[model samples]
Target chain A: MESKEINLPLTDKAIDGLQIGDRVEYSGILYTARDAAHKRLITLADAGNELPVALQGQVIYYVGPTPPRPGRVIGSAGPTTAMRLDPYTPRMLELGVKGIIGKGGRGPVVREAIQKHHAIYCIAVGGTGALLNRHIKNVEVVAFEDLGTEAIRRLEVDHFPAIVVNDAYGGDLLEAGKAEYRTKAPPSP
Target chain B: MREIEAGVITEAVAKLAVEATHFLPEDVEGAIRGARETEQSPLGVQIIDEILENAEIAREQMLPLCQDTGTAVVHLELGQDVHITGGFIMDAVNAGIEKGYGDGYLRKSIVAHPFGERKNTGTNTPGVIHTEIVPGDKIHIGFMPKGGGCENMSRYQNFLPGAGREAVIKFVCETVDQSGGNPCPPLVIGVGVGGTAEKAMTMAKHSLFRKIGQRSEDPEVSILEKTLLDAVNALGVGPQAVGGSTTALDVFVETYPTHITALPVAVNIQCHSARTKHTVL
Candidate 1:
């Protein structure tokens, strides 16, 4: 499959053009947040405080990477399940986040939010961290360091791999893919 | 009588913890390799290729296969004839986890409390350890570093005695269907039928140790495994649930004697990165 390479801080054109199941390689910057960091961000948002990182036109990767070894920039950094962050996703979109990257299917609310807010949901292959870290050139803790792995991080990247799971136009690759292959596909022989 | 030192167990645990993370078990690797030949969807095939490449990278770099690195779950079979010369076994096991997680640079995922502070333990101590006393003088350890993704999708059911094989089959298929892309397929579906609730769950987890296509010794149990494997694949959840074939590489069914009124079942879903390694001392 030919993968489209996308530069981050995604523009409306890029988000609008993406379709469910289109393979894409992302470059530039991606902010990292998992459960704890998300909760803190929402708390900050509710209190009318500034977020640690600017969400406008930026991507958030749902990951809690392992500590890097002696010389590495980042350790095994794979996507965690995205559904866990569904509750905060709409609010995140409302705050101007344009793209979300993680693994697995998003809930209905998130799918709706992605369409309404004109954001994209992409997925890197889960459990492929050793390969994934190769694309992440640099990473630094940006917020909530006490949360350890759950702390937010700013990641500089080059050609990070992902596939659009839910595109901005209300297309869902997960559901469509399943429906397409359910009948025509044969069991593994 | 054979004597074993507590420190030795700890050292072994520490070593295996890092090893299991770095190296993908051969059976799992082989099954994934096999998926490429069978996964019909072009995307699914690509994902399989990526997974295989990831395992290679992890081994070569001595890095964890996944960031979750997981909660260290140990199934220890201690010999009845052996005497431990040092400290308590559980304490030693925990010490091993702390050292391994710290030294290996694996993530400490376990929290201090579920409902309270929910603070990270800093050290991945308090690993889930289940010990069984057996007849031999050797201690056998089965270590599985279970990631949160698949563990969350795992299911347990208490079926009425009248609910036969068909109902059980429905439950397994439905479980995988609902799991979708969350557990990271193509999965290793471990089905434990009969026995009580806990026993079913334990058996389901332990059954994952078997190599793909390895059948149960009993003919009837073996048939159920085959049936479930086919049924799970038929659901079309595909690799990573993006769709195609090959939803599950294998469905392993382990059964025990159950009460006259109950038929308990557990489905322990293991992802493509099934990090399990065992040793006998």
Candidate 2:
């Protein structure tokens, strides 16, 4: 339930301290990467080659936004499901990525990566692409433009709203919250 | 037999496809707003508000309500006494899909193959069409744009003859609960029971086109829908399955007679953005 507006140069402590369900107003540079871009990023990091952009303390938003209408900065820019990028997230975190934003819960591998790397996973509301895009102040393609919406775009954001779903401390809001509310079938009467 | 021109049906199908994809039906919008009011979680409330805002943007910008745009699913109720002239009805439907997807700038999501050499169709055509002939002069077309996220989560199960209603209910709830926050929640659960596997699944998908909160025509099925809806919401999957009071917006069940040995059921979980439209001509 804690709320805070954040700016860049985020520390591991700053991200790891968050718990599930905390509201964040993120204002700073966040990069967009989806399935294809995440693969490319990992390859570059593995090859010991320079990344298209620095990952240290950077936030990556998993999205494949629709094309923007003429005169609009971006189109419906919501978080895609997180599990699609679960395979690549731990690698990114190890390479110094600070926060991952998307919808849906991540797998054990990703949760472990967050704890080990002190990174965070934020849940941006799904299907709110247009509303979410309004928070982007500026956007530029950093790499993989041929991936269409899946390209890596460097986005400048202001108070982009999301909930801390998973944090470095190992709090998983999706799991904990669901467990609290899951009504088990009543024992045989 | 009364003859109708292919041009007429083609135009209608195209318009229906574009309209269904471009606009979120009014009832669907209303249901989301209603869910927003009743949802208890603070995060859920914020998410609902953003969804509402997204709807406005989609309308103002004339963009597809969701980027998925979806696979074109056309359901046709053809009159027994009528004959189509100039072209095949299926041809008209495919042409309509192409025109709609091309002209609307929607993402053509259909693939030529599943599993290997998966390639985009370029134009969203060769729709999943179902036709039923009935005693009438007019044609009734239902256009449902089925998105991938929810479609991927759809399930079909064949229950033992003795599994009964409780098993069916458990299956639906378990499936949706497992899909928490993934199918993009505040979902409408469409349950199809008592048919063969494929038939059951199709019925479940078509059941999504039912008006939100409307009861099934069969009283037993209506009761089942209510029971399932209550049980699913009780799961607290909530908006975006992030936890709240409103996991499923409604549950609509469609059933048909089945073989003596099987009690087949299919659950087609759809997100809040259930895009569908219908026209009679």
Candidate 3:
């Protein structure tokens, strides 16, 4: 399958053009956040307070990387389960977050928000952290340092691999892909 | 009594912590490679390839096989005749965890409390340890670093005696279905039957320590394991739930005697990482 190379801070037009099952190699900047950071972001938004980092046109990767070993830019960094962040995703989408990179499927509301906002939900292989970390060139903690692994990070990546699971056109690769391979079980005796 | 030093246990556990995180066990690696060969979906094949590549990278570079290096779960089979010397066994294990996680650069994932505080433990210490007293003089330790994604998908139930084999199979399959791609399929399904609620759960976790493809010594349970494995794979959840024929690599069932009125079951799902290591002292 042909994989498309995409620059981060995706434009609405760029996101709209993508579809479920399309392989993508993402480059440029991607932000990192997991459940804790998501809660903080939501709380700040509800309080009508400014976020520590701007969300406009950025991609948030659901990940909490291991601490880097000596001389390494980062340690094994892979996607966490995306559904855990489902409750906080729609709001982030409303804030103009253009893309999400994580493993697993988003809930219904998050999918609908993706369609409405012309954003995309992408998945990196869940257990492939060591491989994924190689794509990251640099990392900086931008907020919530006290959260340790859950802290928000700004990452510069090169050709980071992902697959679009939910797209602006309401395409869901998880649903489509599963349907293709689903086999009927033998009748229960 | 055979005496074992605290330092010996700590050193062994420390080594296991790093080894379990960095290396994919041979059985697990073989199963994944088999899944890649049999997987029919293009997307499934692609994902398996990446997983295999990830294992290679992690092994070569001494990096963790997954970012969620997991809660350090240590299972100890202590012989009744052995005496642990120097310090408390639990303290030795925790000290080893601190050193291993810190030196290996594995993620410290444990929070201080489930509901309150939620502070990082920093050392990933106070590991969830399961100890059993058995015959003989050797101390056998099994180290399993279980990630949160798959662990969250686990389920337990207390069914009435009327709920038969079919119901148990149905519950196990449905749990895997609801889990879909979240637990990082292809997976290993561990089923614990006939025990008390907590016993069933513990057995479910312990069943994961068995080598992939190894079946229960009980012929009846062995058949049930096969049945559940087939049913789970048929769910069409596939690899990463993206679709394929290999959603589950194996199903391990461990059963114990229970009261005539009760039938308890617990299902523990393990991701493809399947990281485990063992030592006998």
**Candidate structures ordered by lDDT, highest first:** 3, 1, 2
- Candidate 1, residue B8: the lDDT equals 93
Per-residue accuracy of model 1 over A5-102 as CA lDDT, tens digit each = 89988999988788988999999999999988888999999999988899999999999999999999999999999999999999999999999999
Per residue, candidate 3 scores C-alpha lDDT tens digits across A1-189 of 889999887987788679898999999999999999999998999999999999999999999999999999899999999999998899998887999999888888899999998899999999999999899999999999999899999999999999999999988888887777767753342
Candidate 2 lDDT, B28-81, residue by residue in tens: 889889988888888778778877878887777676667667789999999988
DockQ by candidate, in order: 0.57, 0.41, 0.65
Comparing 2 and 3 on lDDT, the stronger one = 3
Query: What fraction of correct interface contacts does each candidate retain?
Result: 0.73, 0.34, 0.76
- Better model by lDDT: candidate 1 vs candidate 2: 1
- Writing each residue's lDDT as its tens digit, candidate 3 over B42-63 gives 8889999999999999999988
CA lDDT of each prediction against the hidden true structure: 0.90, 0.83, 0.91
Say which docking band candidate 2 falls in: acceptable
Clashes of each: 0, 1, 0
Judged by DockQ, which candidate is best?
3
Runs in model 1 deviating more than 4 A are A184-189
lDDT of 2 by residue, A1-189 (tens): 557878875776677567778888898899999877888889988998998889899999987766666787776677877887888888898888989898888899899888888888888887766567678888899898876777899999999998888887898888777766666552231
Q: Report how far off residue A131 is in candidate 3 (Å).
A: 0.4
lDDT of each residue in B1-281, candidate 1, tens digit only: 99999999999999889998889989889988888998889999999999999999999998799999998999999999988879998998899888889999999999989899987888987899999999989999888889999999989889889988886788888889999988988899888899999999999999987887799999988888888888888788899889988899889988999999999989999898888988898
Superior by TM-score: candidate 1 or candidate 2: 1
Q: Model 3 chain A, poorest ten-residue lDDT window?
A: A180-189
